[model samples]
Target chain A: MTVRELAALPEFEAVCLPDGEREILGGYAGDLLSWVMGRASEGDAWVTIMSNVNIVAVSTLADPACIVLSEGVAPDGDTLERAKEQGINILTTSLDTFDACVRIASAL
Target chain B: MTDKVNFHFDIDGDNFTSAGEASVRIKKLLREMGFSPDTIRRVSVAMYEGEINMVIHANGGSADVDVYGDRIEIILADKGPGIPDIDLAMQEGYSTAPDNIRSLGFGAGMGLPNMKRYTDDMRIESALGVGTTIYMTVKT
Candidate 1:
C-alpha cells in the first residue's frame, strides 16, 4: 500500500511524515537497529519501536520508503528533528509490532 | 585518475542520539558521487554498525573514509575496552553492550556480523586494555 493510504488508516497516526503520501512497497519488521540496517530492503516499510535518531540514519541508508514507529513509540526531540531533516516518512501506531505488521500487510 | 577523497569524523560517544551521524554523511556523500546503490548501501551499513559499536562499547571514536576508483575503505578506531575474544564477539547474538544500550534498540549482538555481511572485506584488530580498530572495504 502507498504511505498515503496507510497513514490515512485509523489504525496508525501520522506524527511527522514528509514522505507519508508516497507509495510504500512492503514491510520489514525488526527492533534491532543493526538487523534492520542489514535486512531491510529499499522502499520497505520498517516497523519498530525504536524511536531514536539513528533510525533516521538506518532508514536513509536502507532506503526505506517509510518507518512505522509501533506501539506509540515516542522518539526524542533529536530523533524527531533528525527525521525531519532526513525527510523520511515516519508514522506512529498504538498497535503492537505484530498487529501493526498485519495491518500493513492487509493494506498492501 | 584523482587522489582518493578522504573524509574524517569524530564520533560523539557521549550522546546516543548523535551516534550514526558520520555514517549518514558518508552515505550521502557516496550517493552524490554516484556510487551504485548496492555499494553505497553496503559501505554505509558497515560503517554505521561500526560507528554504533564505538559509541556503545568504545565511548566514541574516529572514523575515516577513503574513496577510490575501485572501492571505498572505512577505518574505525577506538580506545574503549577491547574485545578479549574476537571469535566470540563475531558470533551472532553475542554482545557485551549494557542493558541501557539495549533499551535504545541496539546491542543485539548483530553489529559485527552484520558489518561483515555487508562489506566486501572486514578485519578487526583489538586488544584487552588498549583499543580496537576495524577496517572494512566496499567495492564500487
Candidate 2:
C-alpha cells in the first residue's frame, strides 16, 4: 500500500503527506535513531514514538516511505516543519508501536 | 564532475535538532550528482552517524565531504572530550552518551558501528581531553 492509502485508514492520521504516493514495502519499529537509520529499508514504514526533529533527519537519510508516530506522539512544531520542508511523509496513531506496525504490515 | 566536489559544515553542538543537517545536505547533493542509490545511501548513512556522534559526545564538530571520481571521503573533527578507548567505543552496543541523549531516541551505542558498517573504510584518531577525528571512505 502507498503512504496515502495507509494514512486514509482510520487508525492512522496524516500529519504531513508530502510524499504520500510512495509505496510502503515493509515496516520497521524502533525508537533508536541510529538503529533505524542503519536497518530500515528504503520505502519501509518506520514506526517510532520519537517525535523529535532528529526523526525527520533520519527519515531523510533512510528514505522511509513515511514515519509512523505511535502512541499518539505527535511531532513538535520544529519537527513538523522540517518534515514538510524535507518532503518526508509523517503519520500519527493512538496505537502503540507494535499495533501500528501490525496495521501497516497487514495493509502491505 | 571533473574536479573534486567538497562540502563543509560546522556542526552546532548545542542543538540536537540540527545535528543531521550536514548529512541531509550531502545526501541531496549526492542525489543531484547522479550517484548510484547504494553509493549515496552508504555515504549519507555513514556521515549521518558521524554527525550524530559529534553532537552527542563532542558538543559539536566539523564535517567535510570530498566527492572524488572513485570514492567519497568524509572527515569529522570534534573538540569535545575524546574517546579514551576507540575499541570500546566501536563496539556495537557500547555508547557513552548520557541518559538525556538516550531520551532523545539515540545513544543506543550503535553510532560508530553503523558508520563502519555502511562505509567501505573507516579510521579514527582521538586524544584524551583533546578531541576525535574520524575518516571514512565509501567507494562509488
Candidate 3:
C-alpha cells in the first residue's frame, strides 16, 4: 500500500504532511532500539513515539519502508528534514503507539 | 563481490544521539561495496548495538571492522567499568542502564542479546574497573 493509502485508512489522518508523497507501511512496532535493530525487516513500517534525530538514524540503519509517528506527535525540524533528504517515507497518526501498531499489524 | 575492506571508528560516550553514526557509515559503506542486503543488515545491526553499548557503559570506545570474503568481523574495545557478572549480564531483561536511557527507547537489556541474535559469532572479555571488549562476526 502507498502512503496515501495508509493515510486514507481509518487509523490515520494527515496531522501535518508537508507533501502526501510518502509511501504506505508494511510492518509493525518495537520500542527497544536493539530489538528493532535486530527484528525489523527492510520495507517494514515502523511505529514509534521516539522523537529524536536518533530515531531517524535507526530507521535508516534498519532500512524500513516508512515510519509512522503515532499519537499525533510531530517530529523535530531536523528529523523531518533529514527524513525527506533521505527519501524515507514518514507519517503521523492520532492513534497512540500501541493502537497504531495494532492497526498496522492487522493491515499487514 | 565484496573485496576485503577495513574500517575503524571512535565511539563518543558523551553524546547518546550520535552513538550510531559510525555504524550508519559502515552500513552505507557495506552497501556500496555490493554486499548482499541481508548480510549488510546483519553486520550493521550487530555493530550498531555494540557501538551503543560502548557509549552507554564504557563512556567511549574504539571499534575495528574487517570485511573478509566470507564474513565481516567487528571488534569493540571500551574502557568503562567492566561487567562483573557476565552470566547474569547476558540474561535477557538484565541491564544497568538508568531509567533515562530506557525513556530514550534503549537500555531494555536487549542490546547484547540482539547483537548475538544478528551475528553468527560473538565473544566478550572484561575485567572489573578495566573495561570490556566484544568481538562479533556476521557471515557474508
Candidate 4:
C-alpha cells in the first residue's frame, strides 16, 4: 500500500503527506532513533511516539515511506516544518505503537 | 585523494535539534550525485549516527566527507572529553548519556555499533582530556 492509502484509514490522520504516493513495504516501531535508523528498511512506515526534528533526520537517512506518530502524538513545530520541507510524509494515529504497527502491517 | 570531492561542516553543540543537519545535507548531495540507493543509505546512516554521537557525547564536532571513485570516507572529530574505554563504549546497551538525552529518544548506546554496521571500515582515535575522532569508510 502507498502512504496515501495508509493515511486514508480512519485510525490514522495525515499530518503531512508530501510524498503520499511513496510505497509502504513494511513497518517498524521504535523510539530509539539510532535503532530505527539502522533497522527500519526503506519504504517502511516508521511508528514512534517521540516526535522531534531528529526524527526527520532519521527518516531522511532511512528513507521510510512515512512516519506514523503513535498514541496521538504530534511532531513539534520544527519537526513538522522540516518534514514538509524535506518531502517526508507524516501521519498521526490514536493507537499506540504496537497497534499502529499492526494496522500498517495488515494494510501492507 | 587529490581529485576526490570533499565537504566539511562544523557541527553545533548547543542545539540538539540541529544535530544531524550535516548528514541530511550529505544525503542530498549523494542523491544529486546519482549514487546508488544502497550506497547512499549506508553512507548517510553511518554519518548520521556519528553526527548524533558528536552532539550527544562530545558537545559537538566537525564532519568531513571525502568521496572517491570507489569509496566514501567520513571523518568526525570532537574536542570534548575523550572516550576512556572504547571497548566498553562499543558494547551495545551501554550508554553514558544523561537521562535528559535518553528522554529525547536517543542514548540507547547504539550509535557506535550502528556506524560500524553501515560502513565498510571504521576506526577511532582518542586521548583523555583532549578529544576523539572517528574515521569511517563506505565503499560505493
Winning candidate number (DockQ) = 2
Candidate 1 per-residue lDDT over residues B1-140, each given as its tens digit: 45799999999989887777898899889899998989988988898899999989888999999999998999999999899999999999999989998987898999999989998899999988899999998888
Candidate 2 structure, TM-score to reference: 0.97
> What would the per-residue lDDT of candidate 4 be over residues A49-83, giving only the tens digit for each residue?
99988899899889999999999898999999999
For residue A82, what is the lDDT in candidate 4?
93
Query: Which residues of candidate 1, in runs, are more than 4 Å off?
Result: none
Model 2 Cα displacement at B93 (Å)? Answer: 0.9
Q: How many steric clashes does model 3 contain?
A: 4
Q: Any runs in candidate 2 off by more than 4 Å, and if so which? A: B1-3
lDDT of 4 at B11: 91
Q: lDDT: which is higher, 1 or 2?
A: 2
Give the 10-residue window scoring lowest on summed lDDT in candidate 3 chain B: B1-10
Q: Show where candidate 4 strays beyond 4 Å.
A: none
Per-candidate TM-scores read 0.95, 0.97, 0.88, 0.97
Model 3 C-alpha lDDT per residue in residues B49-101, reported as the tens digit of each score: 88888888889899999999888999999989999999888888899998888
User: Which is better, 2 or 3, measured by TM-score?
Assistant: 2
Better of 3 and 4 by TM-score: 4
**Which pairs of residues have clashing backbones in candidate 2?**
B13-B59
What's the residue-level lDDT of B74 in candidate 2? 95
Candidate 4 RMSD to the correct structure: 1.1
lDDT of 2 by residue, A1-108 (tens): 899999999999999999888998898999999999889999899999999888999999999999999998989899999999999999999998888888888888
Residue pairs that clash (backbone atoms under 3 angstroms), model 4: none
Q: In model 4, what lDDT does residue B107 have?
A: 94
